[model samples]
Target: MRSTTYYAHGLNIKSELFFPEFPLKQTSEIDVIIRFGITNLFNDSSKNFREIYLSKFIQIKITSCNLLYLFWNDIQIFTIKNNEIIINPNTGLDLNYIKFLLFGYGFAILLYLKGRLVLHANAVDMDNSAVVISGVSGIGKSTLSFAFHQKGYKLLCDDVLSINIGKKFQIVYPSFPRIKLWPDVIKNFEEDPEMVPKIHDKTSKRFYNVSGNFSDIKKQIRAIYFIKVTGDIKIKEINPQKAMMELIKSSYCYKLLNHHEISENLSQCSAIVNKVPVKILEVKKSYESLNKLVEIVENDILKN
Candidate 1:
């Protein structure tokens, strides 16, 4: 099989399978490899693995040898060892869904192993710096980030944001050039939702490719916003102490981290809060307010 190289999240990924979600890059260095293969972790008799996290739809296990196994219901099994991800899929799974999982959760795990802080957020480049918008699921993070994209601001990432914390600066790496949106959000943007590709057969969410509007370069993080649905629009900076807690809560795959990683996460979050401004943004829960929301955020960014 011919392998392809792609760049995202500050890493050169080489994979045998083609991933349209990521941008193709020409590079000799391979930071991560993705391939298809059978995973026998569940059948291993040695049983050296410990279950790290389990939910109704997914189960995560880690072996004593440092291999990570992720089983998503009956759909797929991902075995991550070192810099390689081996995927084993069950019958009748959609390739789009597989790519969705690989690009999101699988890559997130890889970033975690590489000691980067991964957040469940969307980011846009503002004045050559990155601004992150995060919240609980279905909180319009992607929609707002797309609004910024519409305003000529380049999108750094959507759904997953990775950061490298240095002594003097926190740099955020761009993810793939894709954003997921609900059907209504697409209609609000005056595009037919049915024309876009569905993220999965079971969901109405669609994937919007923003290759022309993507920022592939890494940038220093300017600020982080935690948004809420409220009656009015407001933005207020949060103190470092409280910001640290919000960062922890917004961490991707927080329950899967070990004790050492948890300690490191705490230290990194503290560092980020001390160096970067964290704020709470409250906005009305209506699509009509999107333009106003964007105006308020841009003004806030300009003022700070």
Candidate 2:
């Protein structure tokens, strides 16, 4: 019983991290097995991880850092690698820590497992389907995501987008459900000062409980808007490859990593480019820019 198994077209996967480099295959024989490294967040860094290899879609990885926790829908599983950690079965998994990881960005890795290689992008729901705004981190992924949320659009996930690639590709995951806003950004959204979550560190964390109906609905991989918050007030489509290149460069599109990582990145990117239409959406640096961009998506691109 293993959490994941990896078999690549070129390399023999020595570690589970290399498994993702291999495209998805349905087989009974396991080439590489990963007994999910699960550990408690409150637990000491020296603690060991619980090893259980089961087949299902999950998004935790064993990299340079320790494995904290993993989410499968609503269920949360905590772990202690190498060491045994028994949590109260009643308490189940820790939601408080999920909020923290959302801020720190553990969800991006999970998005990879589920199918999409998400960058520090942002997304919001419009006319039922979701619209994703992708660009470099400070280019207003969060700011645009929040602005749309204010204008009655449902926030899906920020920073991570789940993409499914094989033949026909699609972005299947909700928008980054939670948002981490700066102190100044918080004041505009919070009517009551006490409504905010507990503050422990310098970063202010805010969690937006996504709707079950919306989360389950895999939003069609509509146009990927490359966000450039320039002083220019313009919203239109540009060359698709040019738009894709911006996301690839900014997100460290690791297709050039190693053969294994490259293979995986290629497998994912090819599907994305072939399936979804990429566009360049440039606007002046303002919250209202998102709305103007949406007008183009709804009127110009998807409508056509």
Candidate 3:
């Protein structure tokens, strides 16, 4: 059986984020392990599949899906047919619907099971620390994430960040370059036409999907920045308790976990608070302001 180390980092509390699971058990086999989280897991937009699915990934569909919890019936797992699949009730993952969930989906599952992630958000290694930027949607997280990259900080991730907690909150995620910025805001970064994709509106806002030169730079979470979007721009430091709240508010997939397994998400964030410093990055509408904020983070975080 092939195995690997697993990590979990939550938003409000700290917990052991390891769960030993076999890889073959995950694929090409009937044996299965299921987990649960703190949310409904099955969110119904009733807005139809079009609004729910992305414009880039419309090829896959789930017209007839069974959106029920695996734990809706039992306590301990029981054996089904040798070819049948068992489910994790507390997790929002719907194994019956598809072959595998994306990275975000898997991360959410790990958190639900109270498993920590080895990496998270947009982070960079500076003097042996992982400076990380995290926030809710439309909070200029991407603006700040890529800014560090431009300043010679290796870009780690764009949208989602995960942290693995053992000795501390060791951040982890696959190599991803560039950030998704508002179409109108792309010009400030010297918008390279080649990097910008065709502008498309998914939910009334224009999305500029862009790419960067370095796409394989991954690192740990040395610092945490909660980008706060408002009518103006500013930067400040918050206490650990407040930092934990912001972490929860900016949690990657907390609400998406309908199965009520939120212990892990909380645990990951707690680990960060206990070990790393979490800060607040307030930004205004102007990209110049964003630049100033970036400079502050780089000067303070990257240098120290």
List the candidates' TM-scores in order.
0.95, 0.60, 0.57
Clashes of each: 0, 19, 49
* lDDT agreement with native, every candidate: 0.86, 0.50, 0.47
lDDT of 2 by residue, 1-304 (tens): 2234333311122232222212344556643233334444446464554422222533332323434354444344433222221222333435454334433344344334333565656666776666777886677777666666665677766665655554655654554235545544556554443465542343454443334223334566666778776677556666656755665664432421335755677656656776776776777776545577556656755564
Top model by lDDT, which number? 1
Ranking by lDDT: 1, 2, 3
Better of 2 and 3 by TM-score: 2
TM-score of 1: 0.95
Task: Identify the superior model by lDDT, candidate 1 or candidate 2.
Answer: 1
In the range 101-168, model 3's lDDT, one tens digit per residue, is 32234334334334444323556545545667776656666667666666665555555565566674
| lDDT of candidate model 1 versus the reference | 0.86
Ranking the candidates on TM-score from highest down gives 1, 2, 3
True lDDT of residue 196, candidate 3: 57
**What are the per-model C-alpha RMSD values against the true structure?**
1.6, 11.2, 11.4
lDDT of 1 by residue, 176-237 (tens): 88899998888988889889889888788899988898899999999899998878888977
